[model samples]
Target: MFDIKQYLQEQRQLVEEALRQYMLAAEGDFAAHIETMRYSLFVGGKRIRPILCLTAARCVSDEPDVDMLLLPAACALECIHTYSLIHDDLPAMDNDDLRRGQLTCHKKFGEAEAILAGDGLLTYAFELISSEQFLGLSLEVRLRLIAVLARAAGSLGMVGGQFLDIASEGKEIPFALLKTIHRSKTGALITAAVQMGAIGGGAVAAQLQALTEYGGAVGLAFQIVDDLLDVTSSSKQLGKTAGHDAGQGKATYPAFFGVEKTRALAIEAAERAVAALVGFDERANPLRALARYIVSRTN
Candidate 1:
């Protein structure tokens, strides 16, 4: 009997507080750039990645206190994610002015500052993960977590997706190619979040496999929903400009599968995500609920 919303709210507060504390602690010579870094990291978002880490950890164990210890690593993922958004919204990239209902980083702070801020946050994220305060996790576990994160955030993962996106622009794309982009761009980090949570909780092979499967489904579902929202929802409802995908001639689920088929695909992905957690107890209910929320959400 757990209140998933309350748990998510509490964890979001903790992650935000930890992020601010981490940003505030940056004082040695980098004070000027810290504000811009903090601006995007602390800006309003659902904190879904960190919450996924916490919730997945809960599935393997019930140590609520570990959340504080895990906060830095969880926040690291968010930092990388936020950095991607900042760069993605740049004029050279998506040419976007707004994100999450506010001016983009490049808009609020000049493009140069925004680019540096993204770089600063991306590097700082690694520093946080490698810090000594990670609850004395063994080197092997830490190395594995670092590897998972690096691969997901690096050229082989998110970067590859970005490349595919750029290359596919204005071209007639096959559904398979679109799936590859979504899997790499969106699915990798989502998969990494779940893997990191499983690692944080010291999960073994079977549990890790289950969590990975769960993350993969939900990750693709998230992208499909995002594609659908871009066409069906509004900027006000989405908290960012809608139809920007089509406007940019970007390949998307809706563009290829049509809106109705894309919606069905998202629902199917949600069902698969839920099924991935079938082995876990009620401790995993939050993740299951999150899967539903992913598809059901208006924004």
Candidate 2:
């Protein structure tokens, strides 16, 4: 039997440790800003993205040392992700006061500093990717991974999603439109995470295709679950504000389909995501578990 919980626990610890290592300490005027940025970056979460990267790398390779090799790259993804959250929570954006069970970055550090901190994290992410440690991979592979990361984080991906999300605010957005928004916003980078791992681990052809499908399915499912949790869960339970989506007049699956249908959709998405990894060996089991956990999580 696959011990999904045990694997997740161990991986979570590894990701947390890696995040701590990635955080740079500031010693001067920007010390407080850096500290606030690090605070949100290290805030407790499941570390899902990095785990997905590590798990995907393991599935297609014979290398047990994949975790050590991919840790920095995985950590860079989190840095980019954290920076997005910090910017997303700004007064001009989601304008929330809480995140990951603590005050939002802008709330803890001034808005200007929070913005710069986010910028700092985003730029630092690419630096980490290009660092000497990750150079163990072929230059071609590293370049490909960097290109993928850049596109996933760029205007055509996450940023474009945010743009549409903001544009759709307070409007009656169609279900299809909402899906398009999420595919770019949440799905693109997630799929990239899986792809990056495969590239980093030297996965070729069919193995890479399977993992990409797996990532795409879960990426959408992740959003569906978030929509469900907004209605069914409490802020304290979620470790962040719940019901904010509806309160903010944002388009969501639940808002259009109702909670019952949305929950069903999440389950279906999760199952499909798991199905995509069927041909892979036991190394893919964690990816399967993560797909299930994404929808099942209360937060």
Candidate 3:
């Protein structure tokens, strides 16, 4: 049997080491600014996006150094994810004081500094992906990867979903709109991570399609589990403020379908994600385990 926990820990270590190597060092006149960015980047959290990126590459390729080849892009994905978390925890956004059991970036460093840090990380993500380190990839492949990241992180995806989430607060929204919000805000980048990895790994058209389907299902499952956790788990268990969704009157799976049904939906989505990889071989087992792991995770 595959040990999902072990897989995650090992993959996370690889990503963390790469992040430390590739991330900007805090130095010189801009030391404080860089420190704020590094603080959130280094602060603990599940490095799910980058893990997904690397795992997806493994699924599609047999190259001995595929993971190393994709490390820069995987680290870039983490940078984008970290930037989103920092901005999401801002006072103007979720207003949370804790993240990964530590003070939120804005709370520890100042609101303005946190905002700039997010911006810096966001921009740095592109820089890292586009740097000469990634030139090993074909120009066309590199461009596609960059485009995928941009579209997922831009106004049409994560940003747009965030806008809808904030706007829908304290208001009853249709189930469809709520899904749109979740898909864009959370699913877009998650799917993009998989897509980029598939592209980098040279997955053929059919494999890419399968991975895209898998990504969408896993992403949906991830958000559903997150919503359920907000209602059922304590802040200490979650490493962040729990029940904030209810406090802010945010639309969530628990609020819409209740905890039991939401939990079932999450499981169902995870199953769908696994089913999407039926055509793949043993190399895709990690992706399958990851989907199941996402729904079952408590924090």
Among the numbered candidates, top TM-score falls to 3
Using all chains and alpha carbons, the TM-scores for the candidates as numbered come to 0.95, 0.96, 0.99
Instruction: List candidate 2 stretches off by more than 4 Å.
Output: 28-30
- The digit string of per-residue lDDT tens for model 3 on 36-96 reads 9999999887999999998999899988688888889998898898999999999889899
Per-residue lDDT tens digits of candidate 2, residues 247-288?
A: 989999888889888989999998999999888888788888
Task: Looking at model 3, report the run of 10 residues with the lowest lDDT sum.
Answer: 133-142
Better of 2 and 3 by TM-score: 3
For 217-245, candidate 1 gives per-residue lDDT tens digits of 99999999999999999899987999999
Candidate 1 displacement at residue 271 in angstroms: 0.8
Off by over 4 Å in 3: none
What lDDT does the true structure give each of the candidates? Answer: 0.86, 0.87, 0.93
Q: Highest lDDT among the candidates is held by which one?
A: 3
Where does candidate 1 clash, by residue pair?
Answer: none
Residue pairs with colliding backbones in model 2 are none
**Which candidate do you rate higher for TM-score, 1 or 3?**
3
Ranking of models by lDDT: 3, 2, 1
Q: Model 3 residue 251 lDDT?
A: 91
lDDT of 3 at 61: 91
